[model samples]
Target chain A: MSSLEKRLAAEKRFKFYGMFAMTLSLFFVLILMYKIFSTGSGAFVRTTINADVYFDPNFIEVSSNSSKKEIMKASYVDLADQVINQNHPGLDEENFIKVREMYTRKFDYQLRDYIVNNPNVIGKTVNLDISASSDLDQIVKGNYPRNVPEAQRKINDYQLSILDSLDSKGKMSKTFNFWFFTNGDSRDPETAGILGALMGSFYALLICFSFAFPIGLLASVYLEEFVKPGKITDIIEVNINNLAAVPSIVYGLLGLGMLIGVFGMPYQVPLVGGLVLGFMTLPTIIIASRASLRGVPPSIREGALAVGATKMQTVFHHVIPLSLPGTLTGTIIGMAQALGETAPLLLVGMVAFVMEIPGGAFDPATGLPSQIYLWSESAERGFLEKTSAGIMLLLSFLIIMNTVAVLVRRKLEVKW
Target chain B: MVDQNSNYALQTSEVYVHYGKKMAINNVALNFPKNEVTSLIGPSGCGKSTFLRCLNRMNDVIDICNVKGKFLLNGNVDIYSPDIQVETLREKVGMVFQKPNPFPKTIYDNVAYGPKIHGIASSQNELDEIVKDSLHRAGLYEEVKDRMDDIATGLSGGQQQRLCIARAIAIRPEIILMDEPCSALDPIATAKIEDLINELKENYTIIIVTHSMSQASRVSSKTAFFHLGNLVEYGETGKIFTKPDKEQTNDYITGRFG
Candidate 1:
């Protein structure tokens, strides 16, 4: 072949390679998305077992003037039990226990919430659809194939008929799982939720943004404008670049050593987690902000100064406004990277099981990635679904954040 | 400090500029008379721009650009003194750059920026009046008066240059230093600016740096020629172009060599 033909052939091969690489990456992403969606989609909806929950006014002993605490202290399990006993009058003792186990572990609490929300439901028989146990949930979700022999099934022939009878009576339903959004982590997979992890991530990110953005921008401005190139500046510049490339988990170690050890703060609190994450994110923000500052043409600065404006005025009013869009884009991307980080969080003790939703930054918490890590390690099949669900949520939050950054850039970016 | 007069708009004596010890402006002295047009004409990098920048301390922004000079405003106020506030001096000596740079804002905002920053205008109506008057003085009012809110950056190059000139005048400076203002314009636009310069000299002391010798002759009464970082000649525009006193000035004028 002639030299030009050989070069053209090389160019064609490069194009094919690029296309092949893109397709390969896209195929992996799609497969991962499908697997995650199929696994976690079940978490967003939940199975419910219909039951007759009679509110006996005599049992509650709740007056209209009674405090909420007094009403809450009353037993709801006995009321639920009375309804079950009345329905199956001739049931044996062992069968009765099995029937009771079908209700969600938090059935008592769920019944109490309902009564508190509806005080007039007293002395009335209400058809309440309560959460099913994860084992029952799995059977209803078709994880336990009914075609299997009685010996090989999670639900036996007797239990299967009971479930089928409930379904035939329109007492078995699958509604959107509101508890999965509102509750926190639970050992009972039926009540496990992402709220605690979500709140922890929220508080951590809020603290991270509040501290990192201004500090990063100021550092960039000082280095780019005030400090001239010299020994001190060189050291700072080199170190900042090095910081961006350092392992993020090292920052967690720093947080553990400095915040928990020296400062004596409680472990796994969102505040310290945020501070650690902020340190990991600072170098990213600084590098991005410096790039943004560099993108502004010097002519803009000269123009402002020529108008008899002070140095500070010129920088703040002219140079900063011009670079703000790029700066914000960089900041958000950094924050997203911080959000998905898991290794550093493990170092800071964010892998612990947290049930209560965090009320403040100081509350002991676990973020989404850490929550997913903990869930995925569980031996139960239920946690596998939850882990995938947590991954989906984290990915969505990242997508939304990046979209907001893009929109902000589009709105604020000036052509000149 | 030698027999300095306070009436001339600007004066420089023994001015030197060093970029890390490499002299860009050697010892030089020049004068700009008030309410008249004076042009500095030179080849590229001859330090005419550097000398103009010293009058307003514009060189202070450059870290390596060291200026050592006696720069007198109205001839005797030592402009380079540490006691002098650079902002106040810069307010008095306004500069227009070689390229027209209008802020990426509305035409009204561009014109109002100077007045706003210096606190020269007191109220909304006063600011509007100042912007309109400045634009009128720059000879760009009639064309852009109807669309004052339109972005200044979106205007034509010649129009943008006029807007920049308007912005400079809004501050009501005593001296306007224009460095190659017409360099980026077409012939027609250059003619318009030259006409505007003739009109501006009635109120403002205009010190213009131009590479175009003919532009200098057309707009200036006094002319200074710079060569190799030194002032080669300073005289009336008519005498300097027709019968230059120095052989080097004549050589440059007659195109013998740059």
Candidate 2:
């Protein structure tokens, strides 16, 4: 064969290899996204049952003049027990326990809140939308396979019978689960939500952005613009690049030792998580920012200087504006990376189960990634879907951050 | 504005420039007579552009560049004095580059940038008038007045160069330095800029660097010819073009040597 023909054939083979690799990567990403969406989409729509809760006047002594604290401190679980007993007439004690298991632990709190919020509803039958427990929820949502026998399934025979009864009665309703978005981490996956972790991630990212954005940009500006190249600069450059590649877990360990151990900062607080993630993200931002600052044309600087602008004015007015898009993109990339980081957070104690949403940076918190890790390690069978759901939340946040960066780049980047 | 017809606008004595021990501009003494055009003509790397940059201290941005000279402006002010800010020096003398570099802003803003930085205009109305006046003086107002809000970079090449000239003129400098300002233009654009320069010399003293000998003869009153970092000839443009003073200058003008 002619050499030209041989070269063409070789080129075609290389092209095929590249295309195959790209297709393989895209296929895996597609499968991963599909798997995550399918498994986690079910978590957002929970199965609920309508319990005809009759508020007897004797049970709830909440008068119109009663203060909110007095109304809250009163016990109202007996009203829920009365409704359950009144509805299930022939159920014995053993079967009644299984019926009680069908309702969420917060059922009484729901009834009390309804009564307190609407004091005029006394002696009226209030149809409270009671959330089914996770086991019955799984069965109603079709997660618990009906074809499987009682011995083989995680749900016991009594629980299945209760779920079957609720299903046959047509009282079960699938509704959007607002609690998943509003509640805190819990031992019961049924009550768990991402609000605490989301807030924690926000606080951590706020700290990361507030610190890393300026410090990283200033360090880059100083190194690239002010400092002259020499052995020291070379060493600094090499160290910064190497820091960007350092194992993130080491930063976690550093935070564990320094911030929590020596500095006595509170563990699992977004403050310490933020500081550790800031250290991890610093090199990334600095490297990206320096590269962008270096990309500006020397002619622009000369132009500004020739116009009698001082060095500081030229940088602040011209250079900063021009490099802003890249700077923002780099910061977002750093934030997204910090958001998904779990191992470092684990070391810094962000893996602890937080019951309340963090009120501030110093409050105990768990990030989304840490929450996912915590759920995945739990022995409860219900936490499997919860872990996948947590992962979906984390991925959505990352997607949002990246989309914002792309939009900023498109809108603000200058042609020159 | 000084009434003395023979007053010199700028003077340089024993000026030397070096880049880390390599001489870029050798000891050279030259004078720019007030309210007239002076042209520096040389071959490639003859330090003409280097000499042009020295007037406004543009080379100060480079760390390795070392300049030593006595520069007197208006026959009294020592430009290289310890207390003389480079910003003030640049404000007194503006520069046009070889490549037309308009900031990535509107044409109006390009002309207004220097004035805004120096606080020459106190209000929006005054700033607009200044931009209009500067653009009119640069001979760009007629073509660009309707689209002053457009980005300066979107203009044609020669228009962009004229916009840069307007930007320089907006500073109201006493002297303007042009470093081959029309070298990147076509013959037609070059002709337009030459006419503009001839008209501008009436209001501002100009120093221009060019490799085109014809350009030096057409636009300048006095011409300094440089060769190998040294001034080989400094004389009236008519005499320097016709009468031979230095062998190297003659050879360069006649295209026999560079």
Candidate 3:
């Protein structure tokens, strides 16, 4: 063959190799997306219990006739007991008490209201479908091994029997979980939700936004637009690039030492979490912002100057508006990365076993990743599924945020 | 053809430019005519484009660039004076770069950017008129009028260059500087730009830097030749092309050696 034919063969081989590489990369990305969705979807559906239990009129009538509001509150537990007894007539005293415990611990006042409002229907059956305990729910959902030794299981044979009965009767089904929204961290995996972590994350993000946005933007402007490119500026640029690659967990360690240990700020609080994440995300924000600012051509600056615009005016009016989309996309991506980070939160005190929803940023709490960590370590057999579910929730948030970034970039992308 | 209006639109005396410790342009003194085209011709690395950029003080944008000596405009104001703002000087002497450097924006936005930044137009309608008129002057309006909102980058290379020229003209500058405007253009586009330069000279004083001696002869009223950062000759374009002032200038125009 001629040399030209050999060159043509080589060119064809190169094209084939390029196509193969692209296909391989796309395949891996698709597999990753599939795995994340498959593992995480189960966390959104929760098993609930549906049953009809009689409400006794005798307990309700006494509370209704009482003048004092305090006496009316005493009937709450009595109503719960009546419902349990009416549902499981053949069960022994201990078994009945265990069944009664399945109702929400916060539903006492709600039970009392139901009894007082419906005295006529107290003896009659009232159909109620309530959230099952996480362990029992896990058993019904086949999360717990059916063949496990009775002694090894957290749920006893009796509770399993009750769950089995409920399942056979088609009274146990997965429902949209309200507890995932309203509840907080519990020693019980069934009671765990992201409310505490979500609040903490929000507070941390607020702090990050306040600190990172202005500082990062200003630093980027100075580096890209204002400062003369020289030895000192080159050094600063190199340091910023290195900072972006620094381990986020190191920032957590730093925050733990400085913000909490040295500065004497409250531990397990969002303020410190925010400060750490801010430090972790600052380099990313600054790097992205500078890149976006540089993306604006020198011609725009020259054009503005040629029209008698001051440096400040050109930057604020033309450069900022053109770069705003890229800046926002960077910020969202940074926040999303911060959202899924567990190492830094672990270094800080976000791993506390918080049982109640945090009221504010300063309120001590565990975040979703930390909660997942907490659940995975529990001795309870049911917490494994809850851990999986928690991971799912965290991953979904990241997906949504990244999707928004992609959309913003596509919508506002400017080409020169 | 030195008109009465041929007072110094721009003047440079003993001007020197250094990049770090290395001298780029040395002791250059020249005058640009009002309402006429002055073309600077030289081989590569001869500081022709550097001399053009000096009129608008664009060298200030480079960190290592340092300038000394007098750069005056309108025979009175020294543009290099401490009190003179680079922004104000650039406003009077608008520039078009070698490669068309239109912003990553709509053609309308690209043209209106100058006027909008300077607040030359009070409203959107006025800004629109200014953009239209400038495009018309740049000889680009009829070709691009239907798609002014399309991204400037979408245009052909020639169209993009003309859009940049329109962008510079929109500022109502007294002097226009072209830095190898036709270097990246096709022969047809170069011809169009040459025609536009001739038309522009009727309203604004124009200075251009070109490596093409034929281009310099065809477009310019006055010509200056530079060799190794030194002004070798300056005279009427006709006399410089037809006759001879210096052996070097003659040899250069005749294609003996750059």
Candidate 4:
């Protein structure tokens, strides 16, 4: 063949190779999406019991007349017993108590109060489909392998039999889990939800946005737009670039030492976690924001200046609006990175087994990643499913954030 | 004979631009006549563009670039004075780059950007008028009038260049600098820009840097020839093109060694 013919063949082969590579990439991405969806979609639904538990007036009066602290201590078990008796009226006392104990080891004071205040509820049974323990719920949801040995399993054949009976009677089902939103962390895998972690993550992200946005944007503006490139500016640029590449866990260590150990900040709190995550995310935001700011052509700046705009006015009024889409994209990406980070929060003592949603920034609680890590480490088989569910939640958040970034980029894209 | 004092538009006396330790433009002294096209013609790397940039203090944007010269604008005002704002200096001397760099925006927005930022237009109607007039002056309105809202990047190379020229003119600069403005355009577009330049000379002083000797002859009244960081000759374009003056200038115009 002639050289030109050979070159043409080579060009054709190269095009074929590019197509093959693109196809393979698409196939792999599809597989990944399929796996994540199949595994994670199940996490959104949870098996719950639907039965009416009549509130006992005598129990409430007894609890109220006693010391407030004493009543609080007994409330969980007391409510559990009342609920069990109301659900299974003919069951023996021992079996009824055992069923109540299976639901929650602690007192539920809130349940007792609802029974006492509503006089109409004393004899009338209120429909209460309380969340089952994670182990039992997992078995009902077909997540737990039924072949596991009875001794090794937290929920035995006897409990599974009861659950099966409940299912047969149409008392158990997978419902849209409102408790998942309302409840806090629980040692019982069935009762555990991300409400506490969500609150913690919210406060931490709030702190990150508040602290990082201004500082990162200002640093980027100065570096990219305003500051005269000199030795000092060069040093700052290098430092910022290096900081972006630094491992986020190091920021956690810094937070552990300075914020908690040195500064006497509370450990396992959203406030400290926020500060740590902010430091970790700051460099990312700055680098991204700087690139966006720099992306604005010098002609635009020159144009603004020529129109007799002051440097500040030109930058703030014209340059910033143009660069905002890029900055927002960067900021969202940074927030997404912060969302899935576990190592830094681990170092800052944010992996505590928190049983209540954080009341404030200073309240001790775990974030989503930290909660996932915490759940994965537990010996309970129920937590394994919970961990999978938590992974789904975290991944969904990341996907949402990235989608927002993409949309913002498209919206703000200047077609120069 | 041209009068010596017709309020000189721009004057440079022994101007030197150094990049680090290396001198880029050495002891260049020249005057730009008002309301006329002054073209700087040279071989590559001769600092013609560098000197054009100096007129607007654009070299200040570069970190390592240092300019040492007493340059004056409009006879007595020192352009390089510390008190002169770089932004304000640039306002009076607008520049069109070698490659058309219309902002990634609608043709209308591209033209209106300068006017909006400068606060030259108070209302949308005023801005629309300015954009239309600027585009008309740049010889781009007729072709692009129907699609003014389309992205400037979608236009042909010559059209985009004209749009950039329109963008520059919208700011109402006194002196417009063209840095090889027709380098990226075809012969047809080049002719159109030359025609526009001739018309523009009535309202603005134009200094154009070009590598084409024919382009310099066609557009400029006066031409300055620069060679290897030195000004070889400055005279009327007709005299420089035909008459014997500098051996190097004659050789260059006759297509000998640049």
Off by over 4 Å in 4: A1-45, A50-52, A55-83, A102-123, A126-130, A138-170, A225-238, A261-264, A290-329, B1-4, B106-109, B115-132, B141-151
DockQ of predictions, in order shown: 0.77, 0.72, 0.46, 0.31
lDDT of 1 by residue, B22-108 (tens): 999988988788899999988888999988888888999999999997877886688889899888888888889888899898999
RMSD after CA superposition, every candidate: 2.0, 2.5, 4.6, 5.0
- The TM-score-based order of candidates, best leading, equals 1, 2, 3, 4
For model 4, residues A1-416, the per-residue Cα lDDT tens digits are 99999999999999999999999999998887777667655556666677777666555544334554544445445556767776766777666654654454433543654544543455456776666666666677677778889887667776777777887999986777655567788877656788999899989998888888888898899888777778998898899889988888999999999999999998999899988889988999999888888888887766555445677977887688789899989999999999888989999999988998998898998999999899889987667756777787888889999999999999878766
In the range A229-255, model 1's lDDT, one tens digit per residue, is 899989999999999999988999999
Error of 3 at A207 (Å): 3.1
Q: Which candidate comes out best when scored by DockQ?
A: 1
Residue-wise C-alpha lDDT for candidate 3, range B37-128, written one tens digit per residue: 99999889998888887889888777788888787788888898999988878878999988887877789998998887678899999999
TM-score (C-alpha, index-matched) for candidate 4: 0.83
Q: What lDDT would each prediction earn against the true structure?
A: 0.88, 0.87, 0.81, 0.82
**TM-score of every prediction relative to native:** 0.96, 0.95, 0.86, 0.83
**Per-residue alpha-carbon lDDT of candidate 3 for residues A170-244, written as tens digits (9 for 90 to 100):** 887778766566677766555566687777777777877788877888888888888878899989989988988
| Candidate 3: segments with Cα more than 4 A from true spot | A1-45, A54-75, A90-92, A101-125, A145-149, A157-178, A261-265, A320-329, A355-363, B1-6, B123-125
Q: Where is model 3 chain B poorest over a 10-residue stretch in terms of lDDT?
A: B1-10
Model 1 DockQ, alpha carbons vs. true complex = 0.77
Clash tally, candidates in order: 0, 0, 1, 5
C-alpha displacement of A345 in model 2, angstroms? 1.7
In model 2, which residue pairs have backbone atoms overlapping below 3 Å? none
Docking class of 3: acceptable
